[model samples]
Target chain A: MELFTPDFGLIFWMFLSFAVLFFILWKFAWPAITKMIDQRAELIDKGVEYAQQARQDLDQAQAKAEEVMQEARRQQADILREADRVKTQIIEEARGEARQAAAKELDQAKLQIDQARKEAEQNIRDEVSAFALNIAQKVVRNQMSDTKAQTQLVDSLLDEIEKKN
Target chain B: MKRLTLIALLLISTLVSMSFPAAASTKGEDHGGEEKIDPKEIIFEHLGDRYGWEVPFCHHKSIPLPIIVFGSDGLHIFSSARVEHGKEYVDGGKIFRIAAEGDFKGKIVEIVDGEETRPFDISITKNVFALILTVIVVCLVLLPLRCYYRRKGYKAPRRWLGAVEALTAFIYDGVIKSTLKDKASKFAPYLLTVFYFIFVMNLMGLMVVFPGGANLTGNIAVTLVLAILTFLVTNIFGTKHYWKEIFWPDVPLWLKFPLPIMPIIEIFGVFTKPAALTVRLFANMMGGHMIVIVLTLLIFIFAQMGMAVAGGTAVISTMFSIFMLLIDVLVSFIQAYVFTMLSTIFISLAQENPHKEHGAAEAKH
Candidate 1:
């Protein structure tokens, strides 16, 4: 019976103490713990988001650098191609000028040679004509003494003319 | 490392076991003979409330507590030693004794006109003292967290405080938050407090020495009060739909008008949930205490046969008691966790949302 009977005083204390404990915990203890937990969770989430954002930004920057490098390489290739074209154009122009200069020099030499050859030919012709005239004068004085010698000279001259024709 | 910890745990429980014999011996000396080792009386004495604490390993010595009682005349305050060993102590011309026989046995009863009358007694019995100590301990352990959080501001707590946080979070995340969902924060304080409170008291009961061995959680009155509080919290915070479903369930209309069976069952269910909570915790702790007491009493019981049997039984009984104590510690944590888990589930049941039905339907596809 004693064990079966509920002790009222102890029950009162139990209720009182538990109520006080609950009130203390509800009003004081738990808010901070739960709040800090929430704050820590929130901070972790923010950190993860920041990391992902940074990774994305890094990827974008890397992609931009890759694009820039590609652009630079293309520009370098274009510059090299332009230089090769310019070098070929300059070589062609130099070859053309050298050929023109060589052609002009050859043309001047041919003209000078032609003029010298004409002057030499003219001198030879003048000398030959002068010698023939001197010979004709001498022959006329000697051949008048004899008619027979003059006819033979005329016939030989005609035969020479026929052979030249 | 694991094996080492187990060894160390067994060693510690052995130390706790040492006090069990000492306590039973002290009780054995009261009967003045080894043959009078009544297991029921010894176990009940250990499990039940007392006016004074039994000093460990000491005979005829108990730490007296303040005995405050409201008798027929008025209120009176005195030390428990005044009524020690069933001695009558006259206070304010009224005779009072720790009643040995009659209806109010093991309780302080007043002898008035040669009649035993129960007083409005609120003396700080062993259980009440232990309960107060538990409250203080809980307060001391938990109250500082508020300030610690205030100072730390989202940073992790230090050392043991971090361990404390882990335990709280386990219940919060594992039990309350999972069941309550978005409403977790609203109910976490009460639930968390209860978990820690019950856990601490359960652990305190395992030790047989001073400041322990109170058997507070095992007491029906205490568990009853705890259940009552849970009952109040559940119904008070119950949602509109919860009450509506209880009063007018979605069962057929004929069931409501003719029988009102659903509502009757629902109302009974509201009380049964807390009732089960009370019995579950009380019985588990009580049974655990009883088993260890019985196991230890085997030493004294077998001693009547012979020294050889007593020695062998002592060795075996000590080992089993140690094992049982270890199991009891685990059970202590489990019972606290279970109580909190059940309470959270119950509150969540009461907190059921009207929109969840649609969500449940949508989830199937």
Candidate 2:
């Protein structure tokens, strides 16, 4: 037997079936199916929108975290800078105090040295005056004993004093 | 305007020519002779022999069984048989001549002694009876189904509708909407009808073994008509965008330089696509059926060779037949889907709007 071939009979049946099928499908099937598909599409759209919103929220959270971290970093930097400034100021203050103390001690030592030097000079002057008085008394006794020798020595001493003045 | 006038003139001339009756060809006339003609032989003489178009693979044979037509004169019997290769044979080696008797009223016209005459008619073909039975079956099955769903106070079941809906949406969403965009919905009803019709016809093709072997979808004429319809729809609804994309595509300098040749090729492509769609579906369905027939024929061929070969060949043919049958079922459905999809795609392409988007975007810009 060869393969099948369509006759008028087959055509008629096919036509009848098609007509009935089209009518039934158009009336009942299309609406429900289209409605379901539409619903599915709506649900998908809503899901995508929700996902987008979630992404935006995540981005905002990330940005907020970054801002907080930057703020913390700034505060830490400021604290370190402030601590450095304070340390520099304290060191400068201490150096200034030390210099002032050193200067005051030097001045006191110089004043004490100047006072000792003046005392020593005054003692030497007193001794020289006492010795000169003893010498004069002795020379007067010798001049009475030996008038000629004393007159000659007194004249020589007077002539030398007159030349120096 | 010129072309239209010429076409109209040609059509009128053709009609006029058809109206002028020509002498009937003697090739169809039956002559009585002294030779005792077998009734079976006479029947086959009326029915034409099968002609194989694709040699050794595909063949087409149409048998016209004798039918009795009841006429006003009385009972007029008409032989549905045809002759081939100048030889008159009834059986034609393949088709069975079915006897029919019915009370059908019609005028009996016949030619005897080179003169027209009338006789009593009462014969119809079993083919006609089969056709009637098939129609009844379809009506009997489908009408009740329709009524049952209507009475349920609810829509038909989702799964049943789901298959249909999927096809509808696929055409609308995947093919039509993508191509036609705004105009797709308008053409949905027609596209849906085409899809379902093709699908059902294809399904019916699978039931060839049920009754008389009838593969409706495998017929080339039917497929050709469908192709013509698609061609008409596509051309009639063709938009500027369709033409622009085909004839004057935005190609680069080197390609665009051969403008005349390229445009002609592009135009040819337009015709070929729909042509391909038609031939592809028709050929696939026909080819699958042909293979099954060839495989079945192998058993007979092998039997003629030897008894041992016949036994082994029968077993192999049986297995092969089963395999082909399964494949044929799949091909039927796939071809139907391919046809529907291509039609929708073509229709949508024709209705597309090229500048609509650009215009809207320009406004925004």
Clashes of each: 0, 22
What i-RMS does each candidate reach, in Å?
A: 1.4, 7.5
lDDT of 2 at B305: 54
Question: Per-residue CA lDDT of candidate 2, range B120-203, in tens?
Answer: 333333323333344445444334444544565334335644455455567557765665566765665456556655655556
Provide per-model DockQ scores. 0.49, 0.03
Candidate 1 residue-wise lDDT, B1-365, digit = tens: 99997787667645544554556556767778664766778788888898999897664679999888999999999999889988999987999998886767788999999999988899998889999889998888877777888886777887878888888878888888888889999989889988988998999999889888899889888888888888988999998988987899778998888889989998998999999999999999999999999988887787666656666677678778888999999999999999999898788777776877554334324
Cα lDDT of model 2 by residue, A73-149, tens digit: 99999999999999999999999999999999999998998998889788878887888888888877766797788
| Top DockQ prediction, candidate number | 1
TM-score for candidate 2 (chain B)? 0.57
Total backbone clashes of candidate 1, pairs 3 or more residues apart or in separate chains: 0
Stretches > 4 Å off in candidate 1: A1-4, A56-64, A90-165, B1-35, B357-365
Candidate 2 stretches with Cα past 4 Å from truth are: A1-165, B1-182, B210-212, B244-259, B356-365
Each candidate's fnat, listed in order, reads 0.80, 0.03
Instruction: Supply the global lDDT for candidate 2.
Output: 0.55
